[model samples]
Target: MAGTAPSPSGAAAAAESVSDLNYLLRPLHWTAVLRHPSGAGRSPLCFRLYTFAMASFTLSFFCSEVIVLYREGTADLDVFTLTLSVADTDIIWLFRMAHAIVCERAFHKLALQVGRDFAEFVTWDDIPVLRVQCRKVRRFTLTYISFGIGACSCYLVSPVSAEGLPFILALPFDATQPLGFGVTWVYCMITTLHVVVMTMILDSFNVSLIAQLRMQITLLSSKIVSLAKEVSERPENYSETYAQYELRYRLLKCIRHHQTIIKNADLLERSLGAMLLAQSLSIGASACFQMFQIATSENLALAAYDAVTSLQECPLSLKRSLLLLMHRAQRPLRVTAGGFFPLSRESFVSVVNVSYSFFAILRNFKNEEE
Candidate 1:
């Protein structure tokens, strides 16, 4: 189950095992960022077109605001803040769109591999674990969507109450007129909804993958620790050779399982490294670090050592396998930010310190201006 390729017959079963993730992926499909798993919904050309249209609409709005700001030459802090906020969101959305387009094939491959890997856990009587994690992921995703919708509602409605456009964009027509206001308002609503919903889906999808990876690692650690107990429980009639064979087989499976885990982590980093780097820079290092708690390899090594010590009389081959597992696990498994720095707590601190230094310099410059 560990390193073995998924069989054709097991494909559907593997898909079923991780069906819970569709809660995240389904929204992405609707947004045309990805296609439906069954490949029944939209065509590739349609997805590409939809993405391009949305990106163009959002970028046009962003440019309108920038042009207005430049023309007005206003020093109002509120106006400046609003334009800055829009710019930030627009940049993030554009980056997400680019990622969806560039990594489309990689995403599909990763999804299939994830489903296949998760199938291995099904035989371990770990359905409950998967279910528990699925429930958590569902709750988190729904809660996030709810909040996003709520915020978007408030943003779209605020201008209605105040009798203005939702955002400060330079339109050709008189936006104060009823017809112009209606059109502009609807445009803002659509763009805002796109940005908010797509952002949530992409971010939540990444987090869900990390969460599932963490769960797999946890299950693997538990399996390693229980190896000795499982081998000891063999039937009384079982000979030493059979017991040794059983131990060796299970140990090899664990090794393969670890290899699969490492492969998934590397795939994730490769496919989403740029997006992760952009998110870390835009959202802050703390958020990135929180999302990157993918695996605890040291615990895996400890569990292997414990399994070896628990065995009253381990064979030389089995002992060597355990030693190798320990050695491999000792080297931490991590995802990096665009192949640059690792997404660890230490890196988070370094980012924060650098950000603060820059902030201080800007503050000093502003003070001198005053």
Candidate 2:
């Protein structure tokens, strides 16, 4: 399993494991499978349609929202709420488009290798840990999508008769006619579902990849520790030269494992660097706007809720493994925005502080005017 091809049974099991880890991305994978159904099974036509649909609908909505916000110019607290909602929508689509354009091919290649790559780390000892990790991610994704659906459903029904409000808050548009309103409402629902699913899928990809990398680092560390113990306990069996040779041979193996870990991390960054950068900026902007709203408006519940939800969920286990992985590697894998700010817990906290400072300034200006 370490250096040779997996047996037939093993391969089958590995495939199942890969599929389980990829549950979130099943829609995208199925799309690819159906699109071509042969040799790479990546259809240009299908991809174009997916990209076109996401961009056209999301961008059109974003443009409409921006136009309305510009015309209204934050005359009231509702404007901030509308702006916050628009930013959230914009960020989701931004990552979706970036994924389609930048990471599509790389993502497919990585997906294809999942079975083989994962087999290297999964063993009887680590199998339980792997299962627990998978279940955690699965639960998070399910809960995340469930929450989105609930929120969207409430928004859909809150309007008096589904004809009083646009599907999304946007520039004044005609949706007075029953048919027009129905179509707009349906489009918005579809768009929201698509965005939520794609976002979960993308997050799943990163979480799984990082989990695997951490597993490798953990296994490698264990091997190194074991090898050192072996050398210390069994030095009587080996002559000086032979003992040195054995140690060197094992060290080389460990070095190769470490190199593989780095390679995987490099591949991940290459595919997702730009997308992560955009997400970091988008999330930061969303959180900042929500913070501003809470500070300025009497209605605290919605803005506070939005702010809490906008924060990304980082599992404690994954965070620990990541910290360990970075420590073991001696080089942290950073996703940076234009090489200026690295996306990490530190950067996220910095963003919040900066947002709060801006909110303070705005509050002071308002106080002076009052």
Candidate 3:
């Protein structure tokens, strides 16, 4: 709000006619975003490397899930060709969560700070459109919240887990392991496409939010300058007190506008960051999960790099995780789905065995942690 750019001739006219569209609409090249945003302060490569690694893991895990589902005969061959319609409800809520974080918590409080800054600059007429956008964001956010609840609660409760116990995962060491390497590549291609398309869509939403903020800021800047000029030119036509009041009123209005913009940006920062975080987690978890799956059929060291590359997957790993978790319904019913109630299994010992076995497998590995 304080940094003043030197004004150009007819700047006000140009501002009024400037394009309202604020962000780029094309699919993203994450490298560019990281390069520009990180500048001299932090290593952009740090985040990029971490994210890319995570994404790779997620795709691998998802491919494992798809393979498992195929083994169960629940999905069709066409599923291999189909693009999944993403469940964006979680996304919308993620945005809301960011807003609440800024408004109510510490990490995103910058939103409030920025909002306060922007409020110092805009007017009343501009408020209506901005308000409308806020309301839309709210509604979008609420729907996402509702969706997350339903996905976790409604679909996770399965019946098969308790009944069969460990029969499914008991690895018939000789159980004709899943498809061959050719099949692995097939699975990779399918999953890779899923990741790409979904990520583009996901990235677009964040970019759109940024674009909207940019456009609004430009509009508000013009309005503020226009108001200042009008007051200056007409001062002789009004009483001293009236002119002072008008000036104060306009300044206050701008303050409010500045606050709103700042709030929105802050909300977006956290929201966008959280989104990327969620994606990162998905990518990492799914990649690990897939590595675990591939290890099930193929050699562990055979494709370490491919395992790492799974992070490039666009949509990251959340949906894949959800889908894989959904498959858990038939496997051991750790999650909800297939029935309205929890499985009737003995809990404490089973949980311990599963947890212990998962870690014990690690100790036997002769390979370095690399």
Best by lDDT: 1
Over 11-111, each residue of candidate 3 has an lDDT whose tens digit, in order, gives 32232223122222212223222222113246546745644553554444444445444564524322222211121222332343333223333322322
- Worst window of 10 by summed lDDT in candidate 2: 31-40
> For candidate 1, which ten residues in a row score worst on lDDT?
285-294
TM-score for each prediction? Answer: 0.70, 0.66, 0.32
Error of 2 at 9 (Å): 8.9
Off by over 4 Å in 1: 1-15, 40-43, 160-163, 232-237, 284-370
Model 2, stretches more than 4 Å misplaced? 1-20, 29-41, 112-114, 117-129, 160-163, 166-173, 235-247, 297-370
TM-score ranking, best first:
1, 2, 3
Candidate 1 lDDT (Cα, 0 to 1): 0.74
**RMSD per prediction, one decimal?**
23.9, 17.7, 22.7
Better candidate number, 1 or 2, judged by TM-score: 1
Better of 1 and 2 by lDDT: 1
1-370, model 2: which lDDT tens digit per residue? 1223345446436544733654655655443211211234544776667667666777776776676667667776666566557657665666556565556656655554435555543344444555675577677767876776677677766653235663435535568777777777777676665665556556666676666677668667767777777777884656888788878987887787787678777887897787777777777777666656654433334444454445448666755555554444444344576898976568878999999999999989977974
lDDT of 2: 0.61
TM-score for candidate 2, residues paired by index: 0.66
